[model samples]
Target: MRTPPPTTRPAPPRAPRRDLYAAGAAVLLVTAAVLVGRHIQGSRHTLSVNWPPLLASWDPHLGPGTPAAVLVAITVVAYGPALAVRLPWRTLLPVAWATATAWTFSLALVDGWQRGIAGRLTTRHEYLQVIDRFHDIPGTLRDFTHHILLGSPDHWPAHVAGHPPAAPLTFVLLDRIGLGGGGWAGVWCITVGATACVAVLVTVRALADETLARRAAPFLVLAPAAVWMGTSADGYFAAVAAWAVALLALAVTGRSPWAAGGSGLLLGLTCYLSYGLTLVAVIAAAVLLLGRDGIRRRPVLLVPLLAGLAVVPTAFTLAGFDWWEAYRLLVTRYYQGVGGVRPYGYWVWANLACTVLITGLATVAGLRRSVSGLLVRDRLGTPEARLALLVCAALLALLVADVSGMSKAETERIWLPFAVWLLSACAFLPRPRAWLTAQAVLALLLNHLLLTGW
Candidate 1:
């Protein structure tokens, strides 16, 4: 009776190398399938007919002046780690992300260039139309440049007209690129910005786990809305850049408080630069707060967010700007009447899907990981509870932003992150069942879409 059962040692844990490689390959295949399917679906129109001139204008590494160069540099460095990691799956993850990002961005730039070149080719009136629009300004060219670049509250005409010329910073950057007219350049900037953002997102998710990173890689790279908006739409480049900076901040902050602060500052600038980035700021804040214990010991984590916030508006004010008027004139004009407060049924439906996707994955992850899985659970209080809270906050903020965003514009595309966040939460859960299944289904569907237009 005492010899009823022979004790056996637990089986050794399996190495993740195989799983990681499989995950990476699967994600890329799914991404490629989706893109092909979309292209085959005839959704790929020839927007940029004069792709030759545009391709000739393209410069990979160097752009123009301070801002342009700074942005491109950041874009490349932020993605540098993809080259350093040895895992085949890990390497493929970034490569896939970069490839998709480049394709989508290039497509959009071609579209813009086509439009610009066509306008030039078709009508003498086209160039004059642009100048006439600019010439209608009440002030001198210098005044117009200053006013358009940075709004002037003093002039009521500039205030009421509500359309200050294009952002001078954007134009200045374009000009340095040897772009005399900005139509195509604007498209390029937006695409690069969008690619940078995708890179940041992939990199951060990878930082969490290579497998998880691989899982998230495809959706972001092949996201329809993101590709279309970045490539097909204009004026969203800065918004894309803002998103990249925000995500970068989140990734860096994972290292220490000082990193957190710098991330915060970037987050703050994002808020200033694009109304869309308010969503990012909220997400960044939650990531910081939940991980605060990890960073609080370092303290410097608060500097960047605070400094950026302080500097942006303060600089504007010091230059004799009016805060409230500027807010109404610029901020309100850009973001107003957008994102339906009361959205259509699909809005509610997508939100529900996002919740289920995120929560299910996160729960599975929670079940899979043991209490010993967390590094500081014993000392930092309830790690699960804290993580849950932080995720919840981010979800709530995203929901609010998404809902509000829909009212303003067709933000359904940009809201892909809602789904991503939901999936990410599940990935962080303890079990693989929920996350693996959901992502698998998503990957398959996306693949089907790419391959067969479904």
Candidate 2:
């Protein structure tokens, strides 16, 4: 008789000493940011931020959305887990999106309509400030790099000049379609940003397995990161970047040529949306590595993906918008503006504090489990490890951005694209409702207590 080959199965998860300790570390980081940030802002006054780590101010109050935000939080915490498990896959995706949209909208409304929904993107620093300037579209594209430097004539606004033409062009197209003003812009951002929950769920299901995706759905929907995603253009950018990754997951797993093309299209656009999003390629690389079966015939997928990827840059380049030139000038402009004043020594660590506050305490503990899962040799092919790799890829990208020094303060909002993925760590947690409650409470407190500037 021949002996059958032995197999290794995933062990059941348990509470470890590291879980509590990891969470404690995150809390300590936030406390240190607050204490240290206050001292620097009070003395050197060079942080260029009102709320040390974050860009917001402290204003405790409530509004019409307070009850709704509380109710949504309660409902999600009380029922989201069970419902996530029970719902059909198709139904769950839309439900998650709707719930996330509601949560974001209600939280934004806590600051009321004008301050929250209708005015976020209308400020002097926002993309909307340059809509009229983009009326001469082709001309503007050719002239884009000319205005990137701070000393340039009629220098572009902070938001407009900091990003590629695609960022402001989005609002310009919206205005041309008759949805002008901050209300429409804010609505567009929230509605689209909320879809990121669905994208993450789909990617999780396709890349790892359905079980992990379902476990992650509630956390994705109830994320405190939605506080910034509600109105900021970065929220819109996060959704685009997320769908790019999701489509890439589908393409690599199923080896569908069409899916690869779509993924490529979005991934290219994601780069133009925000330079930092180029780091998403890190996560995409992880997906490719994990999808072993799909990569056997790499050319089948890569060809279409590369083709779709070329469309955006080709169009911009032909139109005379020099992406490379603009970025070089942007680097120089960065050092010339507030980027010059913000102390790298202070922001580098404090930014992680912003991450903890935005992602919530549940993620701290969840990430601890993620790292532990990675250390196991036998579990590399298991669903938990697959998820951990994805989460870690995102963490690596965020850390790279932090270390690059381009992202100092305002990371609470600026890091939304990466922060959304970090919430997926909650899938690794046990006693989900307990952790969900913590996530909910953290979000409610942050929104009601502090006024965010995103």
Off by over 4 Å in 1: 1-94, 105-168, 180-183, 196-207, 232-262, 320-324, 329-394, 402-406, 413-454
TM-score of each: 0.50, 0.96
Mark the regions of model 2 whose C-alpha exceeds 4 Å error after superposition: 1-17
Per-residue lDDT tens digits of candidate 1, residues 1-454? 1111211112225423333443454445434433443353334332111111011122222111223223322343344323323336545645655554553444333334443222321233122223433332333322432332224443323212232233223333454556645455444545454454344344344234344444334433433333233332222433343344444445444554444444445554444443444565555565555555545565554555466457655654454444345445554343332221223433343333323322232332332232223343443334343434434544566568655533222233334333334333332322233333444344223222221100
Alpha-carbon shift of residue 100 in model 2 (angstroms): 0.2
Q: Model 2, range 1-454, lDDT digits (tens) per residue?
A: 2222212233354464566688889989999999999999999999988877888899998988899999999999899998988888888899999999999999999999999999999999999888899879999999999998879999998888889899999999999999999999999999999999899998888888787888888999999898898789999999999998998899988888898899899989998888888999998888888886797866579889899999999999999998889888888999999999999999999999999998998898888888878998978888888989999999999999999999988898888999988989888777789888988888898888888884
Q: Worst ten-residue run, lDDT, model 2?
A: 1-10
Model 1 CA lDDT for position 207: 34
Local lDDT at 277 for model 1: 45
